[model samples]
Target: MRREVPLAITFITGFLLIIGFFIPHDPIGGLQSMFLQWYAIIAGFTMVLGLMTLTRIHTRRIVKRTQGFGYSVILIGAMLGTLVVGFYSGIKYKGLFELGTPFMWYYNNILVPLSATMFSLLAFFIASAAYRAFRARTIEATLLLIAGVLVMIGRVPVGNLIWNKLPIIAEWIMNIPQLAAKRGILIGVALGMIATSLRIILGIERTYLK
Candidate 1:
């Protein structure tokens, strides 16, 4: 009964959305907006569920004294601290996310800096991956290495001093071959998404029921 109900809902919702896309009339067209509002409400509950799940997992790790438990403690502490501040600010000032509110202050000062630091650390990993990829083992790798070096050099002022045409060549490489490859990838992704959506709509993709 549970599975059947959800599958029926999914089928009806997907069919209506498809209909609304093609035939934008009063009865069917309004269903899309109403469904989107329902989606937002459902998403809020799912977010709360996700937060509860995260806290539960981290609390278990801390209780078990697992490796890196200190990190879990810090994570839980920061999450709770942010949540409390956000709720308090929302009730007190009637705006949790206002520019000068405590929530935004925590977001701008603590969260943004932490995010920047994480990304800065990720640069070293990217450089390591690039080093392996740029090895001149094959013709394609050699071409890639050369193009990468040229692109890097052309982006700098020193490259202009060395050769004025370096930037022009770099621009050609990026605009011509790179852009074509990127567009092909995007088209492939769009096709894949359409296929997946169709599969779900047709009830062939029932993994979501699990």
Candidate 2:
């Protein structure tokens, strides 16, 4: 009964959401569009669940003096702080209009910088990883190495000056190999999703809610 109820709710909720996208005139559509605001209200009301869960887990760790418990404290503190600031922004801002003067400060400065830093980190990681992967090891590896370098160089002005053929190499990589591989992956993923969806619809899969 416990498991069944959650599964039923999930199934119904998902169908309604999907249908709402197709039927803009329906009440389901209206409700779906309004769901974000409704969610914030419900989330605010239900925050006690999160607080209790965090307290239960962390309190146990703190009591036991467990390893990395201090990090947990910092993590929880950051989460709570972000939630408080975001909520206050919504409230003090008053429904997407007229005055969130104070909260906008945090949004613009803190959130923007953090987002920029995250993106910069990802770019750095990609460059470093690509450098390590693309070496003249084997035939396939050499091709990958060559393709990646061409793409990287073609993206900027200096690359075109150094190797006039780099752009053409990048174009072939993008048009043929990369495109074919991406399509194959997308088809496989779609088939997997379809299979999983059918299993859920037919009650063949029951582990989803868990």
Candidate 3:
């Protein structure tokens, strides 16, 4: 009964949403809005459940003194500290997300810098990957290597000094080939999503229930 009920709900909700997209009338449109609001409320509760699960797992790890327990301890401490500061600021300032609040300060000072550092580290990995991928083992790889080098050079002022048309050539390659490739990928993704959505709506994809 549990499985059947959820499957029925999923089919109804998905079918209604599809209809609402095409026929944006009073009842269907209103139902769509109500469903969206319900989704948001459910999402909020889901996030709370996820937070509780995370805390429980980390607490268990700490209790067991398992390997990497120190990192788990730090994660739990930081999460709790952030939540406390956020709640306190929300009550004191009547807005949790206002500028200059303690939560915002922590976000701006700590979180942003950490995020930047992580992305900066990606540059090295990207360089390594580029080196491996650009090896001229075949005609295609050779062409790709040449194009990459040209694009990189065109982005710098020295490329302009060496050849005046290099930047224009680079821009053409990006606007034509890169944009076409990107559009092809997006079309493929859209088609895949449509197929998956249909499978779920038809109850062929039941793994989500588990």
- Among these predicted structures, which one has the highest lDDT? 3
Task: Give the better candidate number (1 or 2) by TM-score.
Answer: 1
- Tens digit per residue, CA lDDT, model 3, 107-186: 89989999999999999999999988999999999989988999999999999999999999899889999899999999
- Top TM-score: which candidate number? 3
lDDT tens per residue, model 1, 51-117: 9999999999999999999999999999899989989889888587887888889989998999999
The Cα RMSD in angstroms, rounded to one decimal, for candidate 3 relative to the true structure is 1.7
Which pairs, if any, clash in model 3?
none
Model 3 lDDT, full chain set: 0.94
Work out how many backbone clashes candidate 2 has.
0
| lDDT, each prediction | 0.91, 0.78, 0.94
How would the candidate models be sorted by TM-score, starting from the highest? 3, 1, 2
- C-alpha-based local distance difference test score of model 2: 0.78
Model 2, 15-37: lDDT tens digits are 76677889977588887777757
Residue 185 accuracy (lDDT) in model 1: 100
lDDT ranking of the models:
3, 1, 2
What is candidate 1's local distance difference test score?
0.91
